[model samples]
Target: MRKVAEGVYRVPARAANTYLVEASKGLVLVDSGLPGSENGILKAIAKLGKEPSDLKLVLLTHRHLDHIGSAAALKKQTGAKLASHPFEKPYAAGTLVISAPRAWSLYGRMVRKLTTLEYWSLKLFRIIKFQTTHVDLAADEESVLDGVGLDGSVVWTPGHTKGSVTLFLNQPSVAIVGDLLRARRGRLVEPLLMESISQTEASVKRVLDLDPEIICPGHGKPLPASKVKIEKRIVKPVVVAKKKEEEEDLEELTSGLF
Candidate 1:
């Protein structure tokens, strides 16, 4: 776990990252990470000199398997209320169907490039370990998280998922964006999978409007807000140079170039 702000700690739960906010009432957990991460979460909390019961709420950015993997288990253990966007509530409640994204962008092409054997191995793991839980609270709009000490609000930045949200903090101008943007090499790109391309583009503009200084992404290291380029479409690669080496670097940094 690492502290990204005054009272915010980013905890890594395997591939996904969750946040712990030291609020007035207690600790507010932003995301729950993957399944079977309960042990790590508790250990991290204890390391921070906090107890499991200190957690008051679990806010999910969206209803994806990796992001909400430990929601049910953590809520049960900590007795915390689960919160999500209204549209995402059904997904958290296990009533919505999730389909793999269409292979249209560079990221999608890279995902499709995986060997069949490797792909199936990963699919099998998620199928066996994935679990869904109920959401007790819902955010109606870009409202402040009442009761939490931190001056934070949920921005409805949909596109990566229809119900995606970005949590913004006033003090540090930080944004906890769950899969809205991803770090590949050192630059930001559209997240690996997306539900609606148009909505995702519009959401990027909304995020820029907030002018966050620091971005804590769901899958990569915390990056400066300036590293992102909203004008660069996910399907097109931004070639930085004509030299062979520089071109190679771009290819390595981005998933697929066509």
Candidate 2:
């Protein structure tokens, strides 16, 4: 585990990164990594001189398999309250399964296809499978870290997923964005896959407007927010109707899954 901020530690569990926030009451974990990652996370807590039971909450930014894989095991082991956006509740609760996201850009499209292929390949070989979990708190725009003894707020930053969110820390001015943006060769860039490019741009602007000193992403190393050049290259013109149609299609595709 590496410390990204005052009380924030980043733990690279497996496929995705998981964060541990030191709260007044206990530890608040942000995004449990891939399946079978509970051991590493629990060890991270122990490294901080805390116990498994000291975990107070598990905050999931979205319902992606990589991000939510270990959620169920961790919750069962630590008995921490699991929290995620309302739209992600069913998938996180194992009631619904999510399909691969849609993408507009060529790179994003390729990434999506590769991701879908990898998931099915792993399943076909019986190498891995997604383990569904449950969400205890339906976090939204109004949700604040104060309820969990932390000084921060949950901001809805959809596009990568309809339920995507960024955790903004008040004291250190850090934004723990889950796939809202990623670091590539020391520069902040958008994720490789997104449900809507328009919503992604809007969400990126919202986080930039916050003027966070540091931005911690779900996949890469934390970087200074100053590295982000929102106006120069991030913003682009996208058809609103097309984006809406994509969103509807994504919902339809995932909804059809049992």
Candidate 3:
């Protein structure tokens, strides 16, 4: 685990990332990472001199398997309330399975293929199924985090997922964005897989408008907001044909397991 802000710590849980926020009431976890990640997260809490019960809430940014995979285990062990957007509540609770994203470009197509393969692999092998966990708070709009003992708010930022949300801390001027924007090769860029490019663009602008000093993403290292550039054109969908050359160009970006 590494410190991102004064009271915020980032724990790398398998492929995804989980954040631990020291709140007034107790510790609030941002995302639960992948399945079998609860053990690492629990150890992180212990390293902070806190026990499992110190966890007050598990805030899910979206319904993606990597983001909420360990939510059920964490909530059960810590007795913490789980929170997510209303659109994600059912999926998180195991009522509905998440669908594959709309692929607009070569990178997006690669991601879609990988996602489909991963889904089936998990199901066929019964390796790690997404365990359902009830969502206590259905955050649809700007929700004050004080209710969960944090001096921040969760802003609905859809695109990457219909229910994706970004948590902003007022005092530290930080935004914990889950797959809303990824830090890749020292720059912040839109995620490869998204439901709608238009919605993703709009959400990116919303987060930039917040003017966070530090932006912490779900996949990579935190970056200073000033160093981040807003390339409006990049968010627009590119009409890339499924050609051999185009696929090779996106090799680096599509290398991750995301």
Clashes of each: 1, 0, 0
In model 3, the runs with Cα more than 4 Å from the true position are 117-125, 141-144, 234-258
Compute each candidate's TM-score over C-alphas: 0.82, 0.85, 0.87
Per-residue lDDT for 196 in model 3?
70
| Candidate 3, 161-240: lDDT as tens digits | 89999988887888999998889888988887777778888888898899899999999999987656545765344443
lDDT of 1 by residue, 53-168 (tens): 99888889987766787888999899988888888888767687554543344446467355222353358446656566889887544333775565778889888888988888
Stretches off by above 4 angstroms in model 1 are 110-127, 141-144, 234-258
Best TM-score among the predictions, by candidate number:
3
Overall lDDT per candidate, in order of appearance: 0.75, 0.81, 0.82
Candidate 1 positional error at 45, Å? 1.3
Tens digit per residue, CA lDDT, model 2, 1-258 = 899989999999888888999888888999998788899999999999999999988889988776888898998899998888899889777676577666555566567667663464356225666666668787764544666688888899999899998888887888989988888889888787777677888998999889899998899899999876433343342354347657876998999895
What local lDDT score does residue 23 receive in model 3, on the 0 to 100 scale? 91
- What would the C-alpha RMSD of candidate 1 be, to one decimal place? 7.7
Name every residue pair that clashes in candidate 1: 24-149
